[model samples]
Target: MTSLPEDSPPLIRDNDRDTAVGRLQEAYAEGHISHEELDERLHQVLTAKTRGGLQSALASLPEEDAGTTSTIAVAGGRIKRRGAWRVPRILKVESAYGTVRLDLSRAVIEHPVVDIELQLGTGGAKITVPRDAIVEFEDLQTGWKDTRYKTRRRPRSGGPRIRISGTMGFGRLKIRHARR
Candidate 1:
């Protein structure tokens, strides 16, 4: 049998297509692209067969804000965020004697990578990440309780990468992916 041509383009996967679509949606939501442009780009992303084609579809979109950071600190109370919130590129959360809950399932995440630094003392934390998110907590240090997380062996391709690091003292940290 004859060998295949070397010039053939690399095929694109479903997850890659989903990622492009997400970027397009974000650009549209941020007013970087008009409705018509979003439609056109979305169509291109849906029909693209190769990585180059996908890149072309995402061309000219504004880059995400990579320098933005937000901090949430509580000395003796609960800190919670959920429901359509805007997620910054870097987030620092500190709790001295209360619980911290962060629900990112419905949040608008503009960046592809997000960093979360947690410092907890005598309080627990429950973090619900987006369904497609890839979580990394290798740099976290625990005191009395080990973090509760069901690690994914094969992370999805199109979701944001959440990097979590910091210290937890005498409190448990529970992390789960969103169901919906």
Candidate 2:
């Protein structure tokens, strides 16, 4: 096999491409970039073959903030958050024996990525996300019941990404996208 040129930039992986695309989307959503600029940058990221090319596509975007995080812990009562609440960048929820309800259909979310870490014991959670949001729960572990979420086959573009993780024992997690 012929060796690649020493000056050739390293090839990028799919995850790298995805990360770049996600950053572009976040910049667009936060009004840091115009629609036309987002389109151009996205195109560049998608077609980039090397790490250098990908980096060029994201060179102008600002760095993501570490952001504020809040945690709610309950031993035996329900925890509910609804009706135009402000959502932080990272939210940690721990419930021992009660249901947790979070309604984000009409809430205020300024960040592009929201992480919800749940540690539940003998309880469950119901989460309602915005219609355009994207949800990922690949890191969640359940002991008795599985999570209940009907994922859209094609999620809409330019929405916040909600990542759910942690362990649940003897309970279920029901997640739904809002209708309005």
Candidate 3:
């Protein structure tokens, strides 16, 4: 079989495509991409078919100086990630006595799927994704805890996916769809 373009964007759904376009616009506003480059990249983002494709469109632009890992640890407070934020490849969520929420409705996912490691104690966590997003819950070690997956039905293709693996203690874990 032939190989796909190295710079090709990952196949994303319409929602992800729209979010990627928004990020391209932000890069333009931040002077990371020129007018022509923005236009070109926007086109690519709109038509990207793989995660690499979208990433290649912005490969030439400056990126956020954030840390490599995405982590949220809560002992007694709430942690929420919303709006057009970058979705890390690997995420770690820990809660001891508070709640953690990861909203992927408007997130800019860098990969076709993300691995989330969760550890909870006397607290809860919730993840909200787009209606069409796919979610796979892995082996979870829970102690008197409740876990619920309320996300919409998984699509055959094009949508982002999340794989969750971890443990919980007297806490609740839920995966739900965004209220569009």
For each candidate in turn, the TM-score is: 0.64, 0.74, 0.58
Candidate 3 lDDT over 1-180, as tens digits, reads: 999989765567665676577567778878877899888888888777777787788686666434356788867788789999998978898878788888998998866557788888877888888766778775677788667875455454567767788988887888887767
Arranged by TM-score, best first: 2, 1, 3
Give lDDT tens digits, candidate 2, residues 1-180: 999899887889765787788788889989999999999999999998889899999997899676899999989999999999999999999988999999999999987778999999988899999989999899999999988999877789877888899999988999999988
On the 0 to 100 scale, the lDDT of residue 23 in model 3 is 68
Tens-digit lDDT string for candidate 1 (1-180): 997699988889765786688788888988999999999989988989899999999888877445689999888999999999999989999888999999989999978878899998998899999888988898999999999999766677788988899999989989999888
CA deviation > 4 Å runs, candidate 2: 1-19, 22-44, 49-61, 153-155
Model 1, residue 97: distance off in Å is 0.7
Using lDDT as the measure, name the better of candidate 2 and candidate 3: 2
Among these predictions, the greatest TM-score belongs to 2
lDDT of each: 0.88, 0.90, 0.77
Candidate 3 is scored at a TM of 0.58
- After superposition, candidate 3 runs with Cα above 4 Å error: 1-67, 151-156
Clashing pairs in 2: none
Better of 1 and 3 by TM-score: 1
Root-mean-square deviation (CA) per prediction: 7.9, 4.8, 8.3
